[model samples]
Target: MSDKIPEGNRSARERLAQQRERDKGREKRRRTLIVSSAVVGVLALAAVVGLIAANVGKDGDDTASGPAITPSGATGEASLTLPVGASDAPSTLTIWEDFRCPVCAQFENAFRDTITELVEAGQLKVDYHLATIIDGNLGGKGSLRAANAAACAQDVGKFAPYHDVLFRNQPPEPDDAFAKNSRLIELAGEVKGLDTPEFRSCVEEGTHDSWVQKSDTAFREGGFQGTPTALLNGESIFPKKGDEQISVENLKKWVLEANKGKKPGTATPSAAPAS
Candidate 1:
C-alpha cells in the first residue's frame, strides 16, 4: 500500500478539513452577532426609561388631585411665586433657575443671604420661576419633580425656607436622587409643617406638575438666555453691561441702584412658615 492516499482520496480529505474550518468561523461570527444585538437592546431600553422619567411633568397634562395652591401674590396663574417680603417693594427681583443646574446652585449660594436680607427688609419682591431645563438636558425627572415639590411647599406658605433647603441639599447635577418623592419629602422635613401628610400627598400626586410645566413655558416665552437669569425691576442684571460676572457686592449695588430715589415701605413679614 502507498504511504500517501490516492490523489482522489487526498483531495477529498483536504476538502473536509477546509469545510470544518469554514463552519467553525461561521459559528463564531454568529455568537458575536447575538451578543452584540443583546447589548444594543439593553441600552435602548435604558435610554427609553430615562427619557420617560425626565418627561414626567413636561406635557402639562397632570391631573393629580391635591390641595390647590392659594395664590396670595402670584403671577402667571400662580406659576411665579412671591417670597416672604413686602408686597409693594420698590424693586422686583426675578430669578429663573433649574434646581439641578450647578450654575443656579452657585448663584443661589452666593446671593442667598443677601437676597434673604433684602426680602426681609421689604426692599425687594422676589419672584421665583422654576424651570426644568436641566431635566430636559440630563434626561431625569429630578428638575421637574423638585420644581413640583417646591410648588407644593409654596402651597403651605413655606416657599422661601423650603426653596433654600432644596438648594442646600441639591444633589449633584445629573443625579436623579431629587427625582424621588421620598427624597423630596425627606428634605421637606427641614421646614416646619412642610413634611405634613398633605404636602407629601401633594408631592406624590404631582399636584403642581402642570404648574411646573407652565413655569417652563413662561421661561421660554420670556426670551431669556439661560438659567440663574437675574432681573432687577425687569432689567437683566446677571450679565451686567459688559457681561461682567456678578458678585455679592455688585448684586447688592445693582439692587440698591434699582431702588435709588425710591422710598422703601416698612418691612412686613410676607408668608413665612413658623419655625
Candidate 2:
C-alpha cells in the first residue's frame, strides 16, 4: 500500500511548499508590520561620534487621576494632576535601569502604567536612564542596540508602545535573539502607525543612543552608583522591596514623606505599617 501511494504523495508534498509561499505572501499583505532594534547604552554612541517632545492627549492616554508636579516636592496634597497634559505631581522620579536586569523590569512592569497616568496627568515625570550595569561597562552591543531602538520608537511618537515591547522582550544578555535588528523592527511593526522604515533607520545607526548617552552623563554627574536607583525631586528614594513588593500605597506615602521637608537629597524615612 505504501509503495502504491508514493508518487502521488511525493507530488502533494511539493505542492505544500508552494502553498506556504502563497500563505506567507497573503499574511504579509493582510498585516503590514516592522520592528527595529533599540540600544540601551550612551557611551557607545558618543564613542561612535553620534550626536542627537510633544503634547499627549487626556482621555485615551491616562487611565488614572492625579495632580500636577512641580519642581517642588512641597505640595501639601497627597494627589496631584497636570494643568493641561503634564502632571502637577510636584516631583520627577528618574529610574536608572538596565533592560537585562530582571529587577528593573519587575519595577517597571508594576509601575509603568501608574507612572504613565502621572505623566499624562502632568503629575509626574519618570525618565528611564539606561545603563550597562547589567551588561558591564561595555554593556554589550545588544544593550546599545536596544537602547537605540527605544529612542527611535520614542521618535515618531511611539515611545510608550516601544517601551512595553522592550520590557516584554528584554534579552537575557547579548544573545542571538537580541543581535538581530529584525526582532526590534518586528516589535516596532506591532505598534500602530509607527513608521518602521524611519524607526529601522534610526535604530540601525543608533540615533536614539543619544538619550542613553545624556542619561549616563546625568547619572554619573548626579553621583548615582547603583542599579535600580530611584531619584525623586533630586532626592534619592530608597524603598525596601521585600516579600511585600513596592505598591502604589507605598509610593504614595513615600511621595508624601519626601514632600514633608525631609532631609535634602535623601529618601524620606519609611515607617513600618501599623498592625
Candidate 3:
C-alpha cells in the first residue's frame, strides 16, 4: 500500500477542517450578539425605572399627610404667601419660586440687589410663593425641605436673610443638598440668629411639609408656565413685560412707573407670631 493517502481522501479531509472552523466562528458571533442584546435590554429597563421614579408624585397623588402648618406671616389665598418688604409698599411683586430650581436661583441672584433696593425704598413689597415642583419633577426632597426651612426662618422673622443665603449658596440642581436637614441648618448658621434650636427642630421635623405641598398644588393649579414666575403689580415682568425685555433698568422703570403717584409704604408691623 502507498504510504500517502489517495488524493480524493485528502480533499475530503481539508473540506471537513474548513467547515469546522466556519462553524466555530459562527458560534462565537452568535454568543457575542446574545450578550450585547441582553446588555442593551438591561440598560433600557434601568432608564425606564429612572424615568418612573423621577415622575413619582407629580400626578397629584402624593399629598403630604398631617395638618398644614402655615408659616408665620403667610398671607394671601390659603396662607401661601410669604411677604417681604413693607406690607403697604406702593408696588407688589408676586414671585413663585422653588429652592431647588436652578432658574429660580438665577433669577434671585440676578435681581436680589435691585429687589432689595426697591423694597428698602418702600417702592416694592414682594409676595413669595413657595413650591416643590423640583421634588415632583426630579425625584428629590430638596425643594420641599428647603422651602420648609425657609418657612422656619419666617417663624422667627429671619426669612429675608435666610432666603438670600439659600439662593447665594444654592447647590446644583441634581445634587439635592438642600434635601438634608443638616445642610439646611448649616446654611442657617450664615444668617444671624437663624440657627436656633427651634429653627433646627422645625427643619428636622419638616414642620411645614404639608404647607409646602399645598403651595405646590396651588402652583400646579395656577396654570403658570414654571418656577420663578415674577409679576410686578399683577403683571408678569420676568423675561419681558409688554414689548420690552426685562433688565435691571426695566425693572426699576416698571416699579417707578407703577408707583408714579403713590406714597411709599411706612414701616409695616411684623408678622403675628405663630400660635
Give the clashing pairs for model 3.
Answer: none
Winner by TM-score = 3
Scored against the true structure, residue 265 in model 1 reaches a CA lDDT of: 49
25 in model 2: Cα distance from truth in Å? 58
Off by over 4 Å in 2: 1-89, 137-139, 174-176, 241-245, 256-275
Q: How well is each residue in 1-275 modelled by candidate 1, as lDDT tens digits?
A: 76978999989999999999999999999998787565445433433443343444344323334544433345544436545567688988888877877667766776799988887767787878888877766677888788888887877688888888999898987688988999999999899878888888878988777667667777766776677777887777664534544555667877787788887746664563422
RMSD from true fold, candidate 3: 17.9
TM-score-superior candidate, 1 or 2: 1
Instruction: Specify the poorest-scoring 10-residue window by lDDT in model 3.
Output: 46-55
Mind giving the per-residue lDDT tens digits that candidate 2 earns over 143-164?
5456557656555545557767
Candidates 1 and 3 compared by lDDT, better number: 3
**Candidate 1 Cα deviation (angstroms), residue 144:** 1.1
Error of 3 at 50 (Å): 21
lDDT of 3 by residue, 167-249 (tens): 99999878989989999999999998788788889998988889988988898778776667889988987656888766677
Of candidate 1, the 10-residue stretch with the lowest lDDT total is 56-65
Considering summed lDDT, which 10 consecutive residues are worst modelled in model 2? 50-59
What would the TM-scores of all predictions be?
0.70, 0.54, 0.77
- Give me the runs in candidate 3 sitting further than 4 Å from their true place: 1-57, 60-63, 271-275
